[model samples]
Each structure stands twice: as structure tokens, then as C-alpha cells.
Target chain A: MVALSPDLTGLRTPALRRFLTPGLVALLVLASLWSLSSGAAGLGPGQLLAALTGDGLSARDEVVLYQIRLPRLAMGIAVGAALAVSGALLQGLFRNPLADPGIVGVGAGAGLGAVLAIVLGGLLPAGVLAVTGSHLVPLAAAFGGWVTTLLLYRIATAGGQTRVTTLLLAGIALAALAGAATGVLVYLADDRQLRDLTFWGMGSLAGATWGKLAAALPLIALVLLMMPFLARALNTLALGEAQAAHMGIDVQRMKRRAILSAAAATGAAVAVSGGIGFVGIVVPHLLRQADGPDHRRLLPRAALLGAALLVLADLLSRSIVAPAELPIGIITALLGAPVFLWILLSQPSAARG
Target chain B: MLQIDDLKVTLGGRDILHGISLQVRPGEVVAICGPNGAGKSTLLRAALGEVPAQGRVTLNGQDLRQGKPQALARLRAVLPQDTQAAFPFTVAEIVAMGQDAGDFAPEPGLVRRALAEVGLDHLADASIQTLSGGERQRAHLARALAQVWQPVGPQGARWLFLDEPVASLDLGHQLFVMRLMRRYADAGGGVVAVMHDLNLTAMFADRIAFVIGGRIAACGPPDAVLDPGLLERAYGCRIAMNTAPASGPWFVPQAAQAG
Candidate 1:
């Protein structure tokens, strides 16, 4: 006996959608403003506003605002968005909530690639180095992430199904492999290069310069732009691959595009910011709990929420110890790990999925 | 008409379907039946163009492979055997996925209409992962039905290709699903299903196909294909084909020692 199930068109969270995006936007705005105002220099809101407008702003303040903070802020926004979106995309592709770039070895692969380019760029011919120039490291990192993703995908999937246990185990192996390779590069590097690598490895936004941000932004922006188009396909993918295909998705092509975009995003972010963990894993989970996992909403909202979270984390990294500065990675992990534990503990089945 | 010309499929260097060919016309329900490993599902997939095969499959004279997925989906909807939603998605959300798929203009209230058709209207707000197996099966059927809500679309005749659509349902629900397929066929759409229940297939199908060991052993009207000797050989057991009072031929497998 069928009950008269009426109008399900009401499913779209109308009240939630209306408020969530703007709420995230406002949060990002507040975080950015708060971050810009409080720092080692400690510019108050009015002074920061004055400095921003270039009204009665001193040359020292000008350099601090324009040369120092702006680039870091921009880099934080870009890297944060890229990491979170990459996590969302990877999770969708793998069809598991826990498929993060950092956990799955893709971020380590990207880091290895960046280190390789730095250490091995010296070995390349003068002409080749000239052609690659500033772009070499980030490009190599993206390629490395792409290759690692392909390898993991190949190992974990058979007969159009992915075994989660295999994926996690292979990720552990691949992460070790990448770490070993990175260690070898560190051993080969000279003192100056070694110092750079050490600081970079800790994952700081302090190295955020206009030139470096420029190098990473194009790739990050490209993938962010690609996410909206992927939303429908990713939603369909939540229902297994064959079922997604039956729903008229070009499943194989969608898989390739998702991997490629995720790789590019993660590689670009890691190359510039150095192994920032948990924003990718944390931001999406928070949003999913906030509403639900509809990628159309999730992807864009992820961009805003991720940017806000990272900017706040960056603020804490710089401020918590006052001027000496902690690595942004530390702040993210410290904040992210406990939340992640809560998620794992609360819904063991959803986590397993 | 949906036509299959000598369809053959091989997977992992082994043959799964061997030169199978069949024709299905609009306005009729056809069932593909066989024991386990008989390639019944494979044949259905081949016709749906879900698997690679070395033959021609044409629906309404258009090569199934030539059409883009969007184009093909506009003409037919398939309900796969089992699909897991990786995320927690509500029933209404799942049904709406099909109702407005690929940006097609949905018929007014078709998603609710579909949920009602399957008696899932009461649980429209419930998550799909929370439903029972039969409930999930009917939910998917509703999604498939919503996708091609109109039996006749601008593409002429839309179709429903169901793989064990009622395999998880109770007897009453099984009969309900079969009747739903029959009604779709009668309304000028085609229905091709891989079925497990021979009695239900006999009752609902205009034509029945018996696949045995990657080949079609018999395919004809229910009475013709429901032969005792053929069923026994195809299924490797004793089968009793009995004539009910006023219905088509139906059969039940006899015990190994009973003869």
C-alpha cells in the first residue's frame, strides 16, 4: 500500500542555502580583517583601515601592508581553497570520506617533486633551466602528484571497485617511498638549500611572496574553476561508478578529470605552502555536517570556509608566540586533529564509508 | 524496436556471452531468465550498451553506442542491481536526482509521483542508507522511473532496462514491480529485465528468454519457452510446468529425489 508521498521538491535546504553561503562569506571577511589588523606591528582597526586606504600611511607601514601581509593573505586564501577542494574531489573520486591528499600520499608526492626540482634543477642544461625558470618546481610537483594519484588509483581499484583497506595500505607504502626520496634530496642539498627545505617542510606562509604566490595561483585557480563543473558528476559518483555511468555521466572521463584537478590543486598548494595538513580534511567535513554533502554547494562553500579557516590559523601561527612565529602546519594540525577525532568517534560507519 | 544482432561479450580473456541475439519491441515486456552464471545480466548490459560487445544493438534504429550518454539517457533509464550511496542522501534527494537529471524539464511533481508509485512517499525524508533492502530497491526503481517518466518522449519511445528490479521485494511488492514494468510497456515504452522468478516472468512478460551457459536455450512466448524438459536441462533439475486455472504457464523446481 503506497502512501501518498507528496512534493519532495522541498528537499533543497532553501533556508540553509540562503544563509550558509553568505554566512561563510561574512566569516571570511571577518577573519581577513581581524588577521590584517592584529600582528607583530599591532595595527588597530582604524590604523589598518587608514593603512589600507593609503591615507597618512608611513613608508614602513606601506611595506608591511603591501609587501608582507597582503601576499601572505592571498597565498593563505589560495592554498586553503585548493587544499580543501582537492580533499573534496579526492573523497568523491575514491567514494570515501577519509580520502585526503595528505593521508593518501599525494601531498608527500608533491613535496618530493618540489624538492627534486630544487635539487636537480642544477643538473639540467642551462637552456632547459632557462625555459623552466621560476615555474619548474610547482610544475614538477603537480606532475608528481598526478603520477602518485594514478598509481594509488591503479593499485586500489579492480573490476571497477575500490577497496578502502587496500587504498589506505598502499597510501602508507607510497608515503614512505616519497619520504625516502625526499630524504635523499635533503641529504644532497647544500647548506642554504637545506635550510630552505627545512623551513618549507614545516609548512609556513612566511615564504609567501608575490612571485611565489603568482607561480601557484594559476594552477590553483584553474582547478577551483573546474570544481563547479565537477559537482554534478561527483554527486552522481556517490552512487558507485557504474551507477553514475547509468545516470549518463562519462564515468572514466570524469574520473580522469577529478584526479587531474585534485592533483593540480594539491601540488600547487603544497609547493607554495609546504605540507599544510587538515584544512583539506577538516573544512569539507565541517561543511558536510553543517548542511549535507552536495558538491554543488560544498565546493564553493568549501572555498570560502577553507580560506577563512586557514587565514585564522595563519593568524594564530604568527600571533600565539608573538613575532617568533609557529609553522602554520602546526596550527592546522593542533586545531584539526581533535575535530577529526570527534568526527571519527561520532559516526564510525560514515567514517568507514 | 530494440534490436541486438549476434551480441558477443568477453571479459578477462573468457567468454561471458556467446553470440546472443534478440529483438524487443515497444509495447511489450521481455524477461531474460536463467540460472546463475548463465549470462542473463550480461545480455541485459550488452543491450543497454553498458558493456563492450562485438555486435550491433540499435534502439529505434539508432546504434546504441553512437549516441552520447546524455542522448541515450534521455531515451532509456536503467536500474542497476546494487548501488551504494557513499554519502547519506535522503530519499527525496535521491529521487530528485533522476527527476531533473541532465536538466530535462521534469513533469510536474514527477518525483513525488514516483515515490508514491513505489509506496515510499512516507519515507521521502529518510536517508537511503537507512532503508531496508526491498525499500532501497524500490527507491532506485522510482529514480529510474522518474528519469524517463514519460513512456513516449520527444525521442519517440523511452525505455526501462531493469536488472533484478524486484529481487529484494516481498511477493506482493514483486508483483507490484512486475505490473509497473508491464504498465510502462503497455503505455508504448519497452521493458527488458533480467529476472530470477520464472513464475512472475511468466505472468508479466509477453516474451521470455532462457539463457543457459552464455547462450540462449529458448526464447519465445511463456508457454513455448516454459517447457519441462528445456527448463530441466537449462537449470539442471526436475521442473514441473503446471497449467493454472486461467493464467499462462508457470513452473516450480521439484526436489532432487521427488522426480
Candidate 2:
């Protein structure tokens, strides 16, 4: 049987896109508010608004608003947007929708780095290794992530061509190595460090603070801004490297830039949020269904939807068990696994290859 | 005019196109016809500066190798075989990609006209991923059309390099695309197309270049180059030729052959 034609008339206009994006942004703001107000020490919308806008609120409410919920919300939005944009860029670069930051080993490497910091903090002097020093863990994580990404990139590229299969295989190899190192570090951890390592490995927004958000925000913003400029180049690249070259794009240069940018964004995200799973994998696919596969639309929309999904997931993680919070990664996996299964089951015949 | 002089392309220390030379004048449609691995596509790629080649290609007396990418892009465009839209771009957007929007901005009306020229105006808003094989080929042809649509300069010619532009197309679309190429040449453009179908080549091509192995075996008008002897030498088969009522000569390969 012949496939039915897609109805594209409604989405062909840039004006419609302009209108819809702002509307989605407004919905995201409302969702953020609902998340901030509905926590254990529940603040009413009015009290939350008063705290947010500097009107009037109790000291306890002010502390909850400023200290707990605000930073977590910011981290959720920043990490969510970063992962989604990086995933979208990697997918385009590989021309495979299944490519994600986690699959490429950046997350594993960052997690290993953070775990090592926790384990080693127990042995070192207080001045040399301070766990609460704001920048220590993130700095180490970023360094580890960058090293892994560079190594994988070098192994995959030979004579200026990146083989997708080789890249994936190398990523798997590196991830396994990183995972083994992480296991060894966990085995060597002391009691206090063990608890910290376990909690961080499971992933959380519980320790979110203004300092962490400040470190993550600029990297996410840089990635988002760089992504839109690459829309045309990415569209050409999807046709394959030879075709992209014929259309005047410097394919090797574009691939290098895209990989570095995606690595930086993913590294910063994992450093701050402790490896939130599946937002990168799921958000782009979901956005593709609504915005079509045009990266110009898909990239920005994926960022927004990812931000919204993570915010909602954070809300569920905090509220599902009341006073004791569940890990945010657990919530994302629970929500993402079913959708992933659906996509696997519902694969279009033409997309099989 | 497009001139290719002693072009030799090597890939991985193996020569793919060996010392090929050809010239196409303004208002001419030249067809390169050969067997599957005769390096027809390589010749076109070499001329378009897509492949690393030893010799020179000049368009209107300007060296294509020395020209900047933007300058060369404005001078020519290509439509390759097996056109696939890996992303879900709209038909109009795919066509607009051919032209540099900075120098030759995408006018909606012009995109519509280019699509209409390929009988694809109705599919302008259609998703490129959703189109059939023939529809997608036509959309790519529209893209090439848009690329070469600038006003004639003092040189008065633009070139189009097509590699098997109609191999996957149906007969109707094949003829449609050939007719469009002929129209472009009639309007003082130069088109160098690599074709597998000899009958279509005989009908539309002003000149034919028959390639064998990695070199041009014969080059002339269709009647001179597409003789039975050259077909046997290039394709390694004896063939019978008959004239089509509406088109031109058609060849039927013999049942078996030993090279």
C-alpha cells in the first residue's frame, strides 16, 4: 500500500512558528511555577509570587523559595535544554536519531570524574580537596568529559572522515572503561564519601544551588545560540557528506565544530546534574513528531520541550513520595522507557535501515 | 562554455577517471553514456571540482579550481542520482537550498515557478521525506534550476552537471527532465549529463561521449558514437538497434556474452 501524504500546509510558514514558540514558552513558565509552589513545604501561588516578585512572604517561605526550589528549577531548565540541543546536534551529525550524549560516553566519563572526586576527598587534606568548594566537582567532571570526547573523536576520524560505526564502537569501549573505573572508586570510598557518591550517581536536583546554576547557564546558552546558526549546514549534512560538500559546506570543519560544541554542553550538564538519563534521547524524537525533522524548528522546540519535561519530572521526583524525594533519574527512566518502547514497536517500514 | 582538459581523478591510489577531456559550448546539451563502472560519474564530479583531479576545468575561460566556493556555486549546480531527503524539509526549502540566499535570495514566486517547471507546483508544501522517488528527483532538479537561474552575465552561460539524473525515474519523468535540460540549453545554458539510457541520449543530446573502463571510448554526435561496434566494445555485448516511432534509436542487448 502507498503511504499517505503528510499534511504540511499548516507548518510551512515562519510566522506560525514564531507564534507557536512564544505560546510554548508561556506554558513552560506556568509549569515552572506549579513545580515551585507544590513542594512539601507547600507555598501557595500568591506566596510564591510574592517571594518571587519581592512583595511579601514569611522568612521560612523566603528561605524555601530562594534556597531550595529556585536553584533546582534553574538547573532543571539549563541541563534539560543543554542535553536536548546536544542530542539533536549529534543526531544530525551522525544522521542517526539514536545518537545521544550518554551513548557517546560523555556522561559516563563525567560521572566517573565526579565519583573520583568524592572518593579522593576523604584522603586529601581539607584545603586540598574540599567537597563543598562550589567549583571542584564540576571542574573535574568537565575535564574528564573533554578528555573522553577528544579521544573518541580522534579514534573515529581517520584521513578526515568520521565513520559512524567506528565512533559508536569506540564510545562503547570508553564507556565500559569509565564504568570499571567508577566501580573501583566506589569500592575504595569511605563511609561518608560512599553516601555522597551513591546519591550523586543516582542523579538529583536536591543539592541544586545558585553557584551550580551559574556555572551551567552560560554553557547551555552558548550551545543554544550556536545551534541555530548551524541549521542550514545541518540540513545539508543530513543528505550525507558527499552531497553536503557538493552544496558548498565544509563537511569536516562543520563536524568538528558540532562535536566540540555538543561535548561542552553535555559535559557541563552532567557535571551539574549528576547524569540525568534519557532527556537527550527522548526529547528530540518527540519534538520531531510535532515540528517535523527540520533542524531549524526541531532544535529550538526540542530545547523548550526538554526543559518542560525535566521540570515536570523534577516535580514528580520530589512529590511522588512526599517528604522523602525520589531521584530525578528514576522518574525520567520511568517516563522515558515506555515511550522508547513505543517508538521501537512503531518503527516505520522505510526507516528500518 | 565548459572545458575539461586531461582530467585524471584518483581515489586511494587507484585511478577512477583517466585523462578525460571534453568541451561543451553554450546552448549545448552533452550526454556521457557508458556501462555501470565506466567512470561517467567521476568525470562529472571532477569537472565540478568535487573530486581531486590532476588536470584543469574552465568555465567561460575562468579556472574552476582557483574560483572560491561561492563563485563556483554561482556558476554551476549538480543533481546526483539517488536523491534522498534525510531530513523532513519542505519542497520549497529544498529548492531554495540550491541558491545562495545572500546573492540570489529565495523569492517564493521563483521557487514556485521552478517547481512548476518540473510539474511539482502542487508538492511545494509537501514534506520532502514523504515524496516518492520520482517526486524527489524532480524536486532536486528544481533545486538545480534555481541554482542556475541568475541573469546571464557577459559570458552568457551557466553550466549544470547531472550524474544519472533520471536512472531511478519513470519514463514520463525521464522525458520530462530531459526536456527541461534541453530547454535550459536552448536558453543558452550548458548541460553535461551522464545518462545510462542510450535511447534518451540519442534523442536529446547534441553530442554524446561514450566511456569505457576509465577513459572516453568515443566522442561525437549520437549517430557516430552510439554505433553497434562502440556499444559492443563498451558494454561487451552485441546489440540490435531499431528506431522508435516517436523518439530515436533504441538498442536491445544480445542474450549472452563472453569478454
On DockQ, the candidate that comes out on top is 1
Encode model 2's per-residue lDDT on B113-185: one tens digit a residue.
8898899999888878778888888898888888787535454687788888888789998889899889888
Model 1 residue runs over 4 Å out of place are A1-13, A52-54, A125-131, A338-353, B106-108, B256-259
Candidate 1, residue B110: how far the Cα is off, in Å: 2.6
Q: Write the per-residue lDDT of candidate 2 for residues A142-260, one digit (tens) a residue.
A: 56776777787678655334565676788899999999999998888888988877666667888788987886666677788788777778887766666666666766678777876
Docking class of 1: acceptable
Residue A42 in candidate 1, Cα distance off native in Å:
1.9
lDDT of 1 by residue, A36-106 (tens): 77777756688898866768877877787778888989998999999999988988888777678988899
DockQ of each: 0.48, 0.39
In angstroms, how far off is A336's CA in candidate 2? Answer: 2.0
lDDT of 1 by residue, B100-211 (tens): 5633454667778999989899988777766888999999899888888889877788888999999999999998899899999999999999999999999999998899
Where's the lowest-lDDT run of ten residues in candidate 2 chain A? A1-10
Question: What TM-score would candidate 2 get against the native?
Answer: 0.87
How would the docking of model 2 be graded?
acceptable
TM-score for each of the candidates: 0.93, 0.87
Q: Candidate 1, clashing residue pairs? A: none
